[model samples]
Target: MPHSHYAPRQHASARADAPRQHQPARPDAPRQHTSARADAPRQHQPARPDAPRMSSTTSSIPFVSASMDLSQDPSSPYYVHPSDNPASALVSPVLNGENYNHWSIGMKRSLISKQKLALIDGSILMPPKTDPTYKAWERANNMVISWITRSVSPSIAQSIVWMDKTYEIWEELEERLSQGNLYRIAELHQCIFNFRQGELDISNYFTQLKILWDELDNFRPLPKCTCEAMPDTKKYFMEDRVIAFLRGLNDTYAGIRSQIMILEPLPSLRKVFSLVIQQERQTFGNETDMKVMAINGPWRGRGSSVNRGR
Candidate 1:
């Protein structure tokens, strides 16, 4: 019964010659070889012209790769996305000579998102000339330099083209173009002082003022005040801003401004904004009513003069 016609070929004498007729693709089979090549199957082998032989006893183990590149890994510090290029400006606005502050802020934000800020910020120091990593470091440095060059205007790029390191170019730009935030702070103050609701509506005027105030805040953050009197320093500054907002409003809001001032603790900037918007709506409604009444007639005003005026 052992060699009966009904028996499967695997259970027959053919099992003895299975190594030649059918070589199973087992992962552990390499360990059994007395002499293994230096370039074994475990190493990276290019796609061969012949199809791989697979059998029922094939191993599921994956082959080991020879390459150790981390550029594909998102979490790796050395990782660079395939899409990122030097010609692509990560920021929307290009850096001209005058807009250093805005441009620098935009660039810092873009660099931080890419995880390549370390390359320029001195976190990744240059390795030795003899070191293998020095080449990689140099490549990344060039990439950052290219990005900066493309982002700035041609004149600025020409000045920084000869610079070796990323940090030097960045520092040089800051040194050359940045007139210190003090000048910007003063300019902001003057603009804010002069800004008023002349032709602009309440919402538009407030938006303009808010933008200036926000930019100024970025340039000059309030100092840390641990003293007893200055414990709530930001609160006082906020109140001052509220006053500034009111001072810039059109004269039509004099009544509204006076009412807001009489409050002991003073209303917040947000509260004042809402109140002024409401007053603007009411004033607009009154003006509209006056226009409609003037067009209709003086029927209610002088009894029968409505028909005479027509």
Candidate 2:
């Protein structure tokens, strides 16, 4: 008789080479119920009501960063509050504590370009509440404040942060920095006195010299005398400037200096500057010619030797 199928095989060794078999799942087992959380779609957080909204049209502008743009885009890193800050893209000169005069001049040019000079120059006073221009005045005031805050260093900005009016900030900066202190004037004077052309080309030398002159002038400007002695004073001042310029030149200018010194009444500083510049050009030309001749000299001798050998 055949053995029952459910019974363990008597010849287990004979079935060892066959694949192993496992029982299937029973119908009595409980089924799994999948949670909605595992399959639900993701949701985005709503934007804040107070946040700036970027206009779709803004995408058309080239090279505009969201932060630097004045458009309503709070997501931009450089976005400034419209009511509290000026547009960050405004042209401004970086103002360090030093060189206030030049800085102020450059800032003025920038303000003029923007037509906002009246804001800082005290030409436009505060408008009355009933005036139509009051809104404009307020807008200009905010813009000027923004410009000042962005232009100055943090330490300097702290000094003028409390200033409300454009003129007030301007005046405070001028009073604090523009007044030529005696010590500063002396330092600039010494700088001018010791300045020399050295190895610098005439243009660079003159540029450095002019910087000293400008700084010195800021400290102790030429007197604006209109009296009977003004003519003599002007002449003396002119001669002094001429002497200062001539003294700083290279030794190569010695002959030119002598020619200028003997000019009876001495020409104007402008005329003297022109003459010196022309002399510099001529000197440079001569130097270039000499260099060319020296370089050619060696080649010419080599060529002659080669021809003679041939």
Candidate 3:
């Protein structure tokens, strides 16, 4: 298994002390708007003569122009869409330490959808106060924190709420939950070896086996080097998986498995699965045929007796 190298997010204190390039304010910069009489009482202005009277439904309602593209806005990265409301986005499967891998994957996908993945992975750098992008960056970071807090169960959230950075929270949860990876892999391997499909439908049986296979693969990903030997490694690994899959199949598939094993060049896992599925369909088809024959047996017997009598 190729392990992921996750660098922890730098602490806030470290970032604060780092040197920054500052741009000097220009003498020709735009002047701030100010009231002529600062001490004067505020007064409401009359509406323009051409202005339409506000209806009850339209009063005080802000209308966004159709041409407005939030994505083009400088602060759009921090702007959460209505469809991506934080509370709604928090509907992801809760992490209870047991299903960390699945939960993490789901949570990550949700974050990615909202363009907040950088907050979790530290892909985006924090900008200085003078930077124009600072506000958007800060808003996005806070939104992610809120989302994280709302998504997790109270017990899990409480433990991580103390961490400020999204990456820190992410790293903390991973450290706490991903402790039994090796043990889990061993358990899955044993389970695979001892699996027996019994009376379960072939589709369901294969689905169960696939879940374990996928989990095992995630825990121990195949090597990435595309050397000539990589194919052999993949073949060896896939062969083991296929064997495990076939070994667990019902006795009815014995002939199919035997035929597959005797082939000169072994089939891929997908091809093997397809063959097994076909065999399962055929098995059911045979059962159906036997049922039909049985139903017609009495009729055929009666017809023969009549012919003999004639």
Looking at model 1, which ten-residue stretch has the lowest summed lDDT? 301-310
Instruction: Give lDDT tens digits, candidate 1, residues 1-310.
Output: 8666557766666777776554564544764563366457545364342335353224333221224444555865467677879788766578888788888888988888888788777787777988655666677788888999999998888999999788778888888998667888899999998888775667768888998998898888788778876746878999989999999887888999999999989888999999998987787855434433544556644332222110
Q: Write the per-residue lDDT of candidate 2 for residues 122-142, one digit (tens) a residue.
A: 887787978655655676677
TM-score of each: 0.65, 0.59, 0.65
Q: Model 1 — TM-score against the truth? A: 0.65
> Candidates' lDDT values, in order?
0.75, 0.68, 0.71
Mind giving the per-residue lDDT tens digits that candidate 3 earns over 6-91?
A: 22234544565453322123322322223524323333234432255555336545444333444456444556665555554454
lDDT score of residue 154 within candidate 1: 87
Error of 1 at 18 (Å): 65
The lowest-lDDT stretch of 10 consecutive residues in candidate 3 is 301-310
lDDT (Cα, 0-100) at 217 in candidate 1:
85
- Candidate number of the best lDDT: 1
RMSD of 1: 16.6
